[model samples]
Target: MGHLKDMVGANVAELVVVRHGETTWNATDRLQGQAESDLTEEGVKQAQAVASRLAKTAKHISAVYSSDLRRASETARIIADAIGCPNVTEMESLRERHLGNLQGLARAEAHLVEPEAFKASISSDPDESIPGGGESLNQLHLRSKHALENIARNHLGQRVVVISHGAVLRALYVHAKGCQPAGRVRNTSINVFRISASNDWSLSLWGDVNHLQGTNLLRASQRGDEMR
Candidate 1:
């Protein structure tokens, strides 16, 4: 928000989108969706670690954006403070896929409470929304696409950091890259992409957690919930 309009721009825009740090719900095997949860102690450290990595290794950041949820906003604030970016634009479109009645419920509990919704969530058509008020995978993909296109169009030639959730990032990955992520998108993992002047999407990096190389925390099961 700092004279972003005044600065001359370039032909391409770089977006370094990151998933928020781990939360108490994440640790407890609960689905967060659009619900609320705070970061754990390790989550705080993970944010700090990613912030440090961005400060040291990334290009000059022109803006910071975050999902309006607490976890994503908190992570964005940490990274913004570390990198000297003063403003973070929180957008609802950046929020996670709404899990509807399944929100705040752990996997087993969700299956027990809403059997049909649970079944749909795991193996339903992409066009089907979850029970209650949740978004389907197709809905999420479209939202992610539009949000990213808007951001790229608004800030052409600049680099920005977007803090978001797992499902949202997964949507972005699948829609933009045309393939699923190879593994669980780790907490605070940095995924880089660029949008050209012609509005074409290109991937530059994925699941980069070099900041946490010494830690033993990167062993997320390639099999379980990428929607966390």
Candidate 2:
């Protein structure tokens, strides 16, 4: 793919992790864990920005993977087109954390309505499950871990891009950086990591949203250099 020509080699696979472009729910601050939503006009532009920037990585990405969710799928399509990748592969393993009962609730509403429950659910031990049919943080960690390992093993030396939901990325980052999973990930943020030749993974950058530096699409909720 055009976005990955510079990343193929015999040493390690450079992994480019990007959150999907914005959706209506995203703008509304709606919780969309495992919920399917389409990209908004702003999201299309955001994905284009990512493609414009990543097209320069020159890493020969051997493969492209995206969550089956519509927003992620659409965002992946834009990147694939920019990089000339023949296809975008859909992988269910990359879906967002199942928020279950919290699926459609607004963030503020959830917090104000159930502060204690929300706090408990997002504590240090992500294993705590949410109300309704949501999955425990542990489950999220396990699925994402399995998916990442599989990708590393199957495409050891090839660079790849994964378009996933915010929660899925958070789980991955928490595991990679040994941090607590809470808060939000910026829209269209790019995180870079690599599967080393020694069979270890290292995160190079987290939540880089520089591509939106001069764009008018910066979310109203974001401030300064942060993509909140």
- Measured against the true structure, the TM-scores of the candidates, in listed sequence, are 0.91, 0.85
Q: Please write out the lDDT profile of model 2 over residues 14-79, one tens digit for every residue.
A: 778898888888777677777777788988998998887887754566678998989889999999
| Model 2 ranges off by over 4 Å | 1-11, 111-120, 181-184, 220-228
- Candidate 2 at residue 38, lDDT? 75
Candidate 2, residue 224: Cα displacement in angstroms equals 17
Error of 1 at 17 (Å): 0.4
lDDT of all predictions, in order shown?
A: 0.81, 0.74
lDDT of 1 by residue, 173-227 (tens): 8866898776577888888878877778887788887777777445421212435
Provide the lowest-lDDT 10-residue window in model 2: 219-228
Q: Name the lDDT value of residue 148 in candidate 1.
A: 85
